[model samples]
Target: MAMRDASTQTEATGPLVQFARFDNGKLRLFSAHTHELRYFAISHVWGDIGWRKIPGIDGEFLVSAQKVDFIVNQLPDLVGDTPFWMDTLTVDQRNQAEVIATVQNIPAIFRDAGKTIAVRENDGFYACCADAIRDARSIEEFRNQMFEHCEIHKDHVQEETYLKRLWTLQEILLSDTVQFVAIRGGNMDPIRPFSRMISTIHPLEVLGASFFENISFDCVLVFSKAYVMQEVILRLPAPLRTRRDSIYNDLFPMVHAASNRRASKPRDYIFATMPQFPWYHYPKNAERMEFGDIFLDYWEQASKNGFLSACKMKASMIEPQVRRDLGKSWLPSEIQPEPACLGDFLKLLGGQLPGKSAHTGTNIHVTRPVCISPFEYDHPSDIIEFIARMTQRSHFRFCLSCSTGEIPKDQGLKNIPWENNLKDINMLDWLQDVLGQNQSVLPFDSQAGNEIFSNDMRSQGASQANHFHPDELEVARDYLYTIFFYKNANPTEDNAWWPGVRDSLCRLFEIAPASHRLLPILLLMTATICCGMPVSATAWLMRFFIPIHVQFGEISHIGLLARHENLQGHPTPRTMLCVGQHLPVAPLLAGEGLHETFFPIPRRHDPKRNVCFGQELVLIDPEDRAPIGLLPDILHADMDEHELWTNIKILYDEIAEDGIRIVPLSDL
Candidate 1:
């Protein structure tokens, strides 16, 4: 999946059927039924392709010249409270709403009357936006309105991290020569900064490996109509509260109380936020899942949409036992926790396995605990590598500059790459340069540890590094180290950004092009497990078994089936015909389609001893028809004990009828 920012997200997939900028001046809605891409813009003004001034969408406009407030009024009543406003708007309304919103809320500082804005950055646009904000009432509100607007704008573009924008905070994101043009006046790039100093609006992105559940950021400042650049400057290194007021020491209670309110209906607007799912488990994406289990993370966004009332109570819905075992006690209350039953866990496992039953099966089956684990929340190595790169940027230090409350004092302008503070000039872990009067930067690519120690006695300039620049090796190392150290650095399981991370990983990355993303979901963490041998090998073989072998396919040992007598929970049943409620796993192991019972290799040989190669095969899905060729031999296809195991390969190909592709588990 791609790293989705707010701008490119508004691009309609398939064919954009309809579009319009509403009189409310803040909404644009569109939908592609086939693609299920319903969009809504809710900020100043959306910037995208239009399909004429369609009728009907010209509904009653509300609010004022301020597009976000106006669009807010235009929406069908009662939806503003939902996590994403799209839940309330109609399909057509959503699309048009998106376009209008994106175009409108563009910061006044970045608005260029008629100048051409490069897709990357244009100075003219920011000037116009800066002028508009001079009279704006609440800076926070303006920032919120703008961010909410852009979130809809770039919800779907795949190459999300390195986004291709339509306008900049100071100019149009597109160039005047081609794809885009100025809306109001002549095309000319602006060469000025915003007239007014716009206060930064650093919104929080949940931390998760999945799509929406945890993709939320610590804080990202709105940079353009559809993009939010990570803020690298802050007044304090702590969580800040709302800037609108000066009351209260900790605003936790206020924020919590505000969070209680919620929308009562389903969302109609569909942007890039889609629920993620495991690929292999989901039939729609089965083929691609061969690489790894698909992670359905779109739920991250849903969860972030302000739906949780009581997480403890909610967990009970899935497994009340979990709640009983784990629940906080408040006041003098005594909700004595219930002891977990080992037997119950066993039964749950057995139910899914073969040769187990409520009447006869006596073993207790337990799976990996349902609670989230450290690995689940840990950022994978791939994304860590990216962090290493991002930290080396001349702008790298600012990436982590964020405050939930007020902005911090600027750390004066200096030039010795800020990878390290300016205490010592030549130590990787030590300060590289002091904060005095040096403006030279070394943007070379190498290990931070190696380069910091040996500086070429010859240099004088600014360090110009991109995301891949190793000058900030310390950045990746420290960022990843911080994540490892911080208990809750990841927002997945605790319900911060799990839904977003899950959905994005499954839909945008896993099921689709594998690495559509530059970094893991939360700065660095993979949501979906790609189904393939290389990754698995790198994990199990390189890390566990063989240290020398780094080859991809050479590590096909991951999919091998062990004699897991407890596959589901109990032993494989030799004969379900004799018993009543045959366990689900018993038949599943009877080769491919075991549900329908159309084909059975072995009817009832022995129910006591473990069932293996000689065991019968039963096909359940295809009208009780038996599988053709060597399916019976395939399931019972053991290598060590059976003599034909050696010659089985030759016979498998010549199975009388059709030619089939067969490879050993080692070859897979």
Candidate 2:
């Protein structure tokens, strides 16, 4: 597509060609909290470095109140005589002022248009370009969008001066080439996880916060020559700017703060606005407090989620320039500024994802499917599920969002509960208990109102689980399905739900998978009535599926690590000595399954110094401990793998030998 400038009269009146541009090495373009779209130092070269119309994904920088303050602080000391301030587009987008000026020079485009040119201004100037634009939508549309743009950023970018200033920044600070710090899973020093959302990662956000505690940068800001007199794109009411030259008034750092310091150019600039306060804001020496385990603090549960590569960051860089040249391009910016609206949030949530949501009927107070005896929840997802199935005729299902560490491993079978806590747990035990007498609880709920399924309803020849006791039903429910838990070599950086722990849900509940793309359908109903297709459903589709749906709010469950993912890499699948995440994490033909891996943490003496391969699963129960071997045919090790297996085998042998010597029935 050919690019267009402001001066070019639209042969066919429509949107102008103000392309999105990027100069900084950034992962994504983000609208700044300030009026101007903020640009960040992407810090790396990228391949797909360009722009797209997508919101939030377009830019790298965020003009927080701080960055804005910092920029103003860097301005030269002479403020009164400064004609005007120009914030130029730094990326290659609008570096060609001549091109912008030529295109913007539309003398006859507007019926009353005189001339349009790029210019900058200082505080002494008149009613200025209170707003800017890369392209004019409609004269009216352009003006309105500029209003909302100004409202959100509190500063404008589409102004000619803004583009000019940005261009200056590129000439001064930015380089055509820079190096990006790379991320490799285990190879990068000590591999640790990162977590967020729960405010557990404040220390990580302060990558350089403390570096500024006792020290400041010896700084210099290179400025470009100023220009004057060009018609401003948008106008505002009394309090806002009034003339073209007045636009420059925005250059000096003046903040709407408690102190309200109106410094056009301060001797030593600090910040425009403060960030969200951390848990520890101030204390005697908190600035010097030790950062205990950075990895543990910021670790996201292991999942190989997706992200834009370095090149993509580069592509997104072009956006700011587009915004700068186009000057407040949005027709109705006030309509959508952020993710406060559901659709807006979903837009940022990527695409039509496959998800599930819980049904109000999937209630805690509701009775459970009765369970038969001699059985227990065999795995983490089973405890309450057994109860939910008693009155039902189909296999139930549920979804959960959790960490890799939350899935359970069977040591020797007494139905060991994984790390999932009771508050984080939900079960169908009540239904199972009620059905224990081999009688239907449906009879008691005569007022359930719905006669068809409410009664002891079933197909004539169907084999219902009614014959089973609550305990037996419990065992069947637990064993029928098992989870497959594996760790991601790299964690998902885009999702906020990770770094989570275990949460088990009925497979049919449909609530948890609300994010998944699956939709509830009329066909799901037909099948349930005719062919009996297990009534398979997720948490999301269930609520609306029921008529006159009553909302039961939501069950609050503790977000825990779902399961420990072993991302290091797994050998090609073969039946040699592999441990799959299931009821029996690793079986031994009824032999032995180890408990956990323990190392000599004390550097040969400190028990704490030992890591479990630094993992917990390496340790095995004394009864289940035994050295198992993998066939050589399916094995391919590049020395590192061999050494790992060898060390693991040694631990297994030693633990087995020692455990057998002292393990008791209670230990199992």
Candidate 3:
């Protein structure tokens, strides 16, 4: 290219660097900071053919396809007298020093440009949407005109490769005005103001039908709103965009939305998004920063700024992936792709506790310091097996006591063993005490039985007449009668009868509200597992199922546990469960020389078998003096193993609650 000097200048005494202007038949460079330069920046994908040398610019490069079409056919008419910035022709990508400098200057280049032209080689849908958007007078009118066209092209819209690219987010956001170029017919669509699009189109309406159907509608709505908000920030003037508080709130959702998008280089995921954060300092040796190092820097900064909570909350929503390892205890993983809203994620984690703040909002609150502790488990499979065995044993013992009319009347059933060995003398002593009382067995319709059933029906929401079919009620009633009276009257000694009793009891536990003592026992057992104590200790503790109070220095309202073995090389380990406070209690071991860390529960069939072995537990820390928020206080109740396991499973599957998988004993 030939160089030419111009009069206008912004600052500095140095010679203004040359920028190529591809107008007319001439190839000439003008001072980037001079000549009152009004340029449109070109953002397009670099295809496989790579860079080719342009004849007039020495060995300096231009993208091969751009030399053939973009400059020759599309630019002259569209840009007219204005100079345009096309990286391929303007920057010497072959020169490492020049490449680094250009990369660092990208934010300024895009921001200063009069407009950004996005060149896509696709046809149909985008062209149609562009035309409709260009003609609409109002957002509602735009929506009305585009809705049917969007539906017809929904598949094409969803499958658009351009939308899935990471750099495109910054390219479109930094520009004041953007024009879409469809290369199919060399059509340059009308320029649409970037800020206007943000205000006009609802993100949900842009979602294709298939994509829309896969997520919860409410979640889609929430995410759609968040998308618009992020766009609004991106369109802000540079100074406002750089404000620490304003940008920090948008980072979580922006990161989440970008997770599934493509990055040619792994580290580009971080670098490409950096333009959105004006506060980010591009490293001196920007290209040398490794992905892990970049992520660590981000984590440290986010934690210091209190953005880590939002990151953690987003991390709780998705499953863990093997390749990406942003797994520090506090850092959220970008490896796991989440398509739903934060509200939906919380619902998936066992529906947020009734009154608790969901923590999905953008407002940054003072986060209390959380104590991290390792849960004791050699393998997740081991915990899974233990849960199964303990659950079966507990179910057996509970059924035996109920069948023999040994359950106490006033305080409900108590002192049930966690073991299955029926020959223990304590069982005989319990049986003798029941026999000596000579308590009269009441009919099923008696006031006490009526009261028990009524309470159960209320808890189960079966009190409403329409809740269950007539036949379902008969099944429930028959099972209750057999366990409560028939089995007691018959007094069978057959070993074969045990299976029926266990099955009947499991069903009863499912429909009936567990006895008052059951919840506390369950809570204690969960806490024991979280503390990394022996399983046998938990079993022994079951004998004293009376009102038990657990104390910890600080407690995690929710936590996850996975085998430390699986997390050896991972920078951030997946958590197993979002253990609510009170139930899963672990000691605060920070600065106490405890290097052990817990991971989230891996999916059962996850190839990472070493991590998936145990029954997951949720625990609390006693030392934390921070406000508990909405964590439920541990209830005082005697719970059978079956009831305890069931509640554990319920909590494990709660929406947005991370980790903690409950594998059924029968399945094991």
Candidate 4:
């Protein structure tokens, strides 16, 4: 039996594809389009370094002598004379144009094939293991025998030869039916489905955990890649032949799996996974394109989920400056993007992706932002206290978004009764009382720490404050989970949330007297504000800061950073644009009159104004008379009840004296 290259017509028609079968003891090769013929596709590790010319009747086909011998001697019996397609003979790799055109179609070839049989050339370890487990009585006995065989064959390969290559993922995943075969005792053992071989691993993992110690550990589980490939393939929704569109949703997981696998060519890493995406097409000039450019191009065209997922991937070198120049400051530069793990991949799929979408060639327009004047601070502690106080204020607003059963229909801020003097009510204590005692307040299981935190926050022990009640402990625990776990979507990145807070607390405590008690409470309040409800748009809005450098100019850029991400340094006055809004809790207020009308108030347009718990008012500079900032048109509960009416009167007077001018700020 002999093989030949695909015909010129076949290469030109679509993807370079050919099928071979033994007719009357002679191997014959014929050309055909995808899905036009019923063929068994062969996926195998190429036995040679690079493509070599194999002499044939009409032209030289791309296949090595080693692979040719295996196909002619073994493939015929494996597929039982059903015409088969393998990359070596099917692809005319000698032609560069044909290689590019057919690279993507390889997956479809395997996918559309009647069956796929992976040939493990020159591998006898699987045969020994199969024979060892054949006569076993129980799963435990089978597991021990397998481990014993592995111990004996320590020098032999620990993993299947076929599964070692990076390109096998696509070959295994896309195929409808797949089985592993090799030269077992000069003839093939009964061909086992890929799943059947994978099934042997669970007994050892589940029931024979201790059996690993008895044998050379690496040898005991010979086909670990099989387990990994099984997991990767199983993640895909079934019936991929009919529903190729479903693969888009599982793009990140496939990418994550691909990162573990490797290809000889750098571009093959991206090309191998391209088939999973039906919408994406490999660039015509893909051979010349850098890996990063190709990667960005692929993800940019991906579904919204995939595009965002790529942005979050961990990379050694990220081009923030390049991204900024590209007008997509939100996206990182040239990353060798890799998701941390399978769990992280699923988290991106299930959890909320990064918010405040700033795409390429777009202005970051920040609407209704509050601007303030620069103030001199003697110490960094002042900044911590400043940030902590602002965090508390933000938390107060965050509570407005949450609704609970305890609050009456008339009440605006539910469950917790916030008083008129907002300064007196501690936001953390309120959250502790509401969420801890009333377990049913949130939709998710509040008590289940593992459900939320991959790293259990409850294990962090008591809060920094020494004397805290059990309920306070519980709140602190859940609060840490809400903050650290959710904020750092990529687990590999440093958990920057607590360290930043700890440093701030340390600086603040150096000056303040009662530092012991204040640390935990302030920390809780900070986390509450930074990561409000994981899914809330209001929570999303809170993370953004409109940087006002000189403290007296039109806002240009709005920066959004995850609190848990490592902070290079403290955001100086130039970067810290403190903007906030008041919660409209007027409906919940026991009494109403002039307060019922939620309108903007007129205060002395003072310079160097800090964020305060005031009603609808965008503080402006009276002396400069500059258009300072914008605020949401809503009433806050903290202002003095009488002061509210006085501001209203002053607002009317100011309106008459100086007609309010609406000036638009330049686009960011």
lDDT leader = 4
List the candidate numbers ranked by TM-score, top first: 4, 3, 1, 2
TM-scores for all predictions:
0.20, 0.17, 0.42, 0.44
Over 4 Å off, model 4: 1-16, 23-27, 50-65, 79-81, 122-124, 135-144, 184-237, 241-259, 304-307, 313-326, 332-668
Residue pairs with colliding backbones in model 4 are: 319-333
Q: Please say which candidate is ahead in lDDT: 1 or 4.
A: 4
Candidates, ranked, lDDT:
4, 3, 1, 2
Each candidate: RMSD to true structure? 25.5, 26.9, 22.1, 20.7
- The lDDT values for all models are 0.22, 0.20, 0.36, 0.39
What lDDT is obtained when candidate 2 is compared to the true structure? 0.20
Model 3, 1-668: lDDT tens digits are 12223312222222234566654456676666522566777777664346565444445454645434655666667667677777776776776666655654566667677777776544223545666545555445555666666656544433333444556656755665556654544322234212222222433333311122223444344323323222211233434244354232432332232123455664465556554454455566656654434554554454454333222212212212221322222233232212122211211121111111222211111112233332222232332233333323233333322322222112212232323212232321101222233321111223422432343422332112121123322232233333333233344454454346545444433343222112222333433323222222323222211111221222222222221112223333222222332112122222444333233522231211111121212321222211111122121124545555444443333322453322211111
**lDDT string, candidate 4, 1-668, tens digits:** 12234534433344546777777666678877765777888887764544454433235555656665665566667777688887666666677777777776886687677777766654434555666766665545656676686667654423344444556756766664556565434322234222223223432232112112223333234323333222211222244432224333433332232122336665565677665555567888877665545666665655343333323321211222232233343333243222222222222222112222324321111213333322222243443444433333343333332211011122111121112312222332212222123220112222332322323322331122122333433332333333332333234676566455546445534544333233334333343233222211211212211112122233221122322122223333322222122221211121222212232333432111211223223322222221122222122334455745543332222332332222211111
Residue lDDT tens for model 1, 56-108: 44453322222233233433232232211222233333354444333222321
Kindly indicate the candidate among 2 and 3 with the higher lDDT.
3
The top-ranked prediction according to TM-score is 4
Worst 10 residues of 1 by lDDT: 542-551
Of the candidates numbered 3 and 4, which has the greater TM-score value?
A: 4
